[model samples]
Target: MKYISKNIVFSVLVLSFFGISSLNAQNDNSKIEQLIEKKRNYNQTEVKSKGYIIQLYNGNETKAYAVQQKFDEMFPAYTSKMKVDLPDWKVQIINFKTRLAADRALNLFREEFVGANIPKS
Candidate 1:
């Protein structure tokens, strides 16, 4: 009877130790998860990088603006910008994060703007 009680006590202590440790582990995991979420939010809000840009039109200012207006009407989801470089004016959709994303945009734009492409940089 004494030996059985001692074994039961030992088992209970071991189980309690593991249970406490598991609780601590869960707390640690929650802290880690919070930190990761914070970092993700910070990255989204603070970091800004110029990724891929697809040039839709490259010619004179008048034609570039015309293309920009047409593009705005066609792809309202995307934003376009006009840049003046020397004698040429460029109308582009900017801030694509990956080549795959740019390629997808290119495919969509290609249906309307035949000259749409992702320029090599």
Candidate 2:
């Protein structure tokens, strides 16, 4: 009877050990999921501010898309946007608030397309 009790106790301990470990594993997975969600939200969220616009195109949808794609390929760090401003398909680069910043970005852009300009914004 004492030997049977010891075997039963050992079985319970082994089962409890696995049960507690599985619970802790579940808690760890929840924490990891929450961290991943926080990181994903940070990357998707955008904050707005006043800035300059560097005009690259003012007409022709096909030509504007081509230019936008080319700009994106060359400067993946900077965002290139295309919009319809009625009577024209507009392509522009945004977020350069200062003349020096705009000029510096323009210099890089000019290396590929010499005609890129930062109009009054």
Candidate 3:
């Protein structure tokens, strides 16, 4: 009889714990939802702007083309283009609106290239 009563008491304690946790979970979810709504409202007034790009390479047409292809394979997310201006071939990443944003990218590219510069657009 004592064994049965102890089992029953344990079961009730476990059930109460789960019930209390579920209530707390619901409250947490409501708070998360409210925060998300607030963030969405704040982002509605966000502004958009333009920046500069980092020049990766500049040399012969064939060499620049190969470098551009390799760079594209390495960083597919960035816009890498090759242009011919006079005697040199230009490989540049364009449209970096902010100096801070451009500098962040410049630091990453500096590991691979020595001539990475954030030129204005």
Q: List all candidate RMSDs to the true structure.
A: 7.8, 13.1, 8.4
Q: How does each model score on TM-score? A: 0.58, 0.56, 0.55
Model 2 Cα lDDT, one tens digit per residue, 77-120: 98888889777988899988766798888888888776688876
The predicted structure with the larger TM-score, 1 or 2, is 1
The pairs that clash in candidate 1 are: none
Clashing pairs in 2: none
Q: lDDT: which candidate is best?
A: 1
User: Residue by residue across 33-64, what tens digits does model 1's lDDT show?
Assistant: 99999988986786445688999988998989
Instruction: Give the local distance difference test score of model 2.
Output: 0.84
* Residue ranges of candidate 3 with Cα displaced over 4 Å: 1-50
At residue 8, candidate 1 shows an lDDT of 100
TM-score-based ranking, best first? 1, 2, 3
lDDT of 3 by residue, 1-121 (tens): 9999999999999999999999999999999999999977875665444557788987898889888888898889999988789799999988776667889999998888778786544
Clashes of each: 0, 0, 4
Better of 1 and 3 by TM-score: 1
Measured with C-alpha atoms, the lDDT of residue 5 in candidate 2 is 100
lDDT of each: 0.91, 0.84, 0.84
